[model samples]
Target chain A: MRPFLFSKSSAINQALAKKNGTTQYIAGGTNLVDLMKKHIAEPESLVDITSALPAKIEVTAKGIQIGAMVRNTPLANDAIILAKYPLIAKAVLAGASPQIRNMASTGGNLLQRTRCPYFYDVTTPCNKRKAGSGCSAIPGENRMSAIVGYSDQCIAVHPSDLCVALAALDASVKVQDKSGKTQSIAFTDFHRLPGTTPERDNNLPANALIHSIEINENAFAKNCAYVKVRDRDSYAFALVSVAAALNLKDNQIVEARLASGGVAHKPWRWLEAEQYLKGKTANAATFEAAADIAIKDLRAQSHNGFKIPMLKGAIETALQQCLNR
Target chain B: MKQEYNFSRRFFLKTSSALGALAFIPKGVKAFYEEVKNFIVPKKEQLPLTVSINKKSYAIKADTRTTLLDLLREDLNLTGAKKGCDHGQCGACTVHIDGERALSCLTLAAMVPGKEVTTIEGLANGDKLHPMQEAFIECDGFQCGYCTPGQIMSAVACVKEGHTKSVAEIKEFMSGNLCRCGAYNGIVESIQKVAAK
Candidate 1:
């Protein structure tokens, strides 16, 4: 790794003012350090923002506000999260190893780059790594590539199980810029599709710091499930995962939210399918139809067509689990 | 043909003139030129750090790019924490930062100034082995023993976190520390033994 200046400060505005395109903010350093060691990322300066960001999980008028620096393990095991947002806890637990969860911060996890093999292998052409460079995954080994919301420029999927649950829960990301101005971005809009600018993963403004994530109270806490299908039962990225939540009244769905992972650049959400499930009886048939609608417009690359059925089954299974609960 | 002696007056005059010109350059411009030169050249940034490790404090100079794992094994000579993958994929570098288990390889040494770091070397109290270490030995929890330190560290944390309810739970919690020798049975038994106590 190249040597660079490292500064630690508790002032957000000062850190943001120092941040440039070549400067990075280090929180947990779980992913950033690894990428730096691989020479995939070479930041000229790194501001240690772990102290700069808030680390508290606070109860708000809205359900809860998770500070950007909250570690994944604490977030997963938080009593409030386990009780009020069980799917979020389950999804966090299902994603990485215990040690990683212990060190990975919430904001860092949201900003983690894709685990696409080409992106890691510097020799390969990865548009996400180098803008305008040809994407090797389109014609090369792409079994783990995106199956939905993929443009010709890139076919990489966001690899956060927590983000999928957040998308389903309609969480909002609050950010602060160098001017100390703050704004909230809906969870679904936080991550971007890999359009012509695959190099840019999220819509977070440059040099802005993520403040916190706000999730509103919902009735689906008791009837929500996060189902992740992967090659292994532990410590692996999802091949296809689903976060399903439903609000039920008299055995009929009052509202539904579904988001999928490992199949899209962003957490794939089907609002139309969710809208279709509303007022419908909660059952396997209805869930199957919803799954079909969710997968109807999804197109797969050459090697990732299997993800279509995997995603459909994952969605159905997750909804069925939610229904059973 | 014979090689000629090349100590020419013209070369000496040119070198002296360049040195004379450099001496006349303004201090600010010279500093700027040095800054540009530093950017073009790769140089290690050495910073003074005071870190607390295993209840002991040490003030040392470390490269800004050095990982906590390297600072432990290479600088501090605490070789108990092994580097398996050095990429956070393998748990051989597991250590405690502020009593919480974390991968030292992923942690920059500069980041742990105010925090306490406990490595495998700190687990045992002088001649007395930690309970988790004793359990591992009693249960034969390792074969090659490369991942033993990390496994013991993770197992200790797992038990303390109240995640050692069953064999499956032990396996799940200890999945980060991979034992390529397939000695998981003994590892799980060791964790269960410690948790049962």
Candidate 2:
């Protein structure tokens, strides 16, 4: 049964402040409500954080600071962000159907749970739920599972397309606490695994409010863009996705950063591959070597074994496209 | 008790008869019934949300169980927004909050207490329609008009935000608002017209 619920963003923080661990904060209700209907998430006392937080997208000294409350459409069209951070715009555009984007936030996008079939099926014995419980998805139907940085416990891919962009951008998140204290978490370290506790998807405690995602002014800022391969044109998660950024100096690769989504438990970064890419004259061959390194030693579930090559191809193709553009 | 028993018996028979007749009902209706199971089954808890629509304010209570789309159409009598999907998958119930396009279906009524909300009903200058409404009608931007309000709202924002640099740019920006009517030609034309002036 769905939980008896009350929704107040402030009340959510207050309730979290008062309670032990029995409430969930809601934004947009796109993912949470959908899961609730599927009987995947049985949240009691849903604290609606939609109205409580102010939505904004601003240019800061560090870089672009997008409030966690700002919707996808605003971010996708923000003039400075679109021109300065086209990867964010492209990534936001490539996500779930437009209507869902209208409701989904960058913070909620990062905070989005996995889209695993077994995870949603309440009857399934998923390790992401009860630690040490066998993961039905690992063997049963993991065609859409991870291809990199995976563990035995869980292989479900992060569903947010926008998160891949933020990860590539090396975005930092600011979260407000119940006591009104604020703390910042790096984009990559924000999401955790279902390891023994596969249920815990994010590092944010119950009372923490995701305030903003601060994009760092890195060398890859202007050159990055997101590309995905999905079953449908839009609204579906990727079979393989790539967020690639390149900075060329003197016709040689001065810097390159690559991150992949829909193919990992977290936003899988290719730091080794990126290091390999620097000081090389970028071409399809250079991208191929880096992509190969990125997918090296990946643990793929049954259906996802095909994703490694697909991801490599996707990254190479996206890199070439950006270079050409 | 006798009359009550008769009413119960009649009710059961009526239900059975309806079920019998429903054998010819479409598969979609059966699926709809199955999908609506949660809506009918009330959980242990619910909360009150006092909200305002158009310009008038309401102090009514709502189920924490309700979506803003249902809260508006079912309880509040503002049926301007249509429910294409209870999921945020569709932009049928898109409305304006402080002049920005928002999906009402994805929003909960309890969430918007002190904010100003403007639905399709409130998008007129004394029955003379907002420029977007008139432009959409003149350009035939909508076919069914079901997704029109959302399209209009998003289109206005797009132009105001100055995303009409090129057709590709407009398509990319407006990609969030879908018109299954295949009226992209008109939709683009309408936005281009508004954006030009």
Candidate 3:
């Protein structure tokens, strides 16, 4: 919470123009402010962009467009999102408490940092915080580290339940650049696999700003659920979570979408398992098989090996609940 | 790349010219420019803040790094909102911003200028206590009462948001407000009593 310059912007171009490597955007201030207070993030200048971005929840023939500044509570309680995309709503509600949901913005949720204990303790060596400093979680306390798509540089997991559902729903993120140019990034490709540069969380450029998220209308609405297994029932990060959506016809699955959280650097979308579930009967056996396939490639650390089976059970339960719904 | 550079340059010129035109306007636009300038630049790390708290407007100067929780307790002497776990984990600093519950500990003071903030101090109307506050007292919702204010604020919001239909829902919605004394039963009862009406 060091003294920093603060500016408010009502224009996107103006905000983006002032943004750079040392300047950070503030919206809701739930995650960013916490990081700043912990000294994990100390930007010299903060450009408040809550007013600069649109806050509308517009529904079109193709899909729904959620503004970046839309608070998590309103997004979760919105009639369109709750009815047409209950998985998204459930995932959002499962993640944080009511007060947090009131202040957390859609775009800020996507950009939230990992909740690794080592990352928060500045005295420890964390590559994500200080590049090339070596990751403490690699050999230290890593019970919550990533189980898949992790490099030696960092093993932290992305702690977001909303992003998992968005990945399963095939959402798209709209971003505007400092030059006033815009581009769309698919939800699956929005977050990056932690490689040499664990410092870079997502594929977004330094000067780019998230505009909105577009989710297409799909048949998974009737049979979808977000199952999160945590240390506690509420107010805790997920130990393993699953966002399952299935299209069932005549007791058989026509299509399926499965993604996992709390186990990877990004939302782990098991495309192979999703493909395997299709054309199979919507039963416990099919779900168990899909869950097995989903965990086959997961490489767990010494302390987090339990997450492998825990994630498998979560996936099975999520699929069963989706079918039952 | 070339087109992007040209566009950015043109945008800068357009904005500067717009500001230049505003400087010549008689009164209204000039005052607007002054407001915009104040918002864009922090004067010596202290900014002018106009916030409405407890239905009272206060024009004050706050540091750019000051959080709403600190501003309330340290500046305004509104100590009803306690600061527990200064981060967003504990909900001891919960307050209502524009009728929605938010963690004041995480909200910066600069962000509440145009919004209405209602803290536990504002819950009681002079001599009459709020329904949720009265219910908390009737049910003995707290043991040590350290987290009572935050719990009461969240409870009121939970009922208004229609999440208090069942015991499980109330527990889930009020999970942020941690009561270390383990008086969860009374807290649930308090919320239930208010929701029943």
Task: Indicate which candidate wins on TM-score.
Answer: 1
Model 2 misplacement above 4 A: A1-16, A50-67, A70-86, A97-102, A121-126, A129-136, A139-141, A174-184, A206-216, A299-306, B1-50, B124-149, B165-167, B177-186, B189-197
Ranking by TM-score: 1, 3, 2
| Model 3 regions lying over 4 Å from their true place | B1-44
Pick by TM-score: 1 or 3, better one: 1
- What is the DockQ for all candidates, taken in turn? 0.72, 0.27, 0.38
At residue B181, what lDDT does model 1 achieve? 94
lDDT of 3 at A28: 87
Record all residue pairs in model 2 with backbone atoms less than 3 Å apart, i.e. clashing: A97-A235, A194-A198
lDDT by residue (tens digit), candidate 3, A1-325: 7668899999889999998778999998989999999888988899899899989899978999999999998999899998899999999999899999999999999999999998899999999999999899988888988898999899989999999999999999999998899999999999998899999899987779999999999999999989999999998999899999999899899999999999888998999999999999999889999999999988999898999999999999999899665
- Evaluate model 3 with DockQ and give the value: 0.38
Residues B27-69 of candidate 3 have per-residue lDDT tens digits of 9877888899876763448999999998999999999999999
Model 2: per-residue Cα lDDT at residue B12:
90
For candidate 2, report its TM-score.
0.78
The CA lDDT of each predicted structure is 0.92, 0.78, 0.92
Which run of 10 residues does model 2 chain A get worst, by summed lDDT?
Answer: A11-20
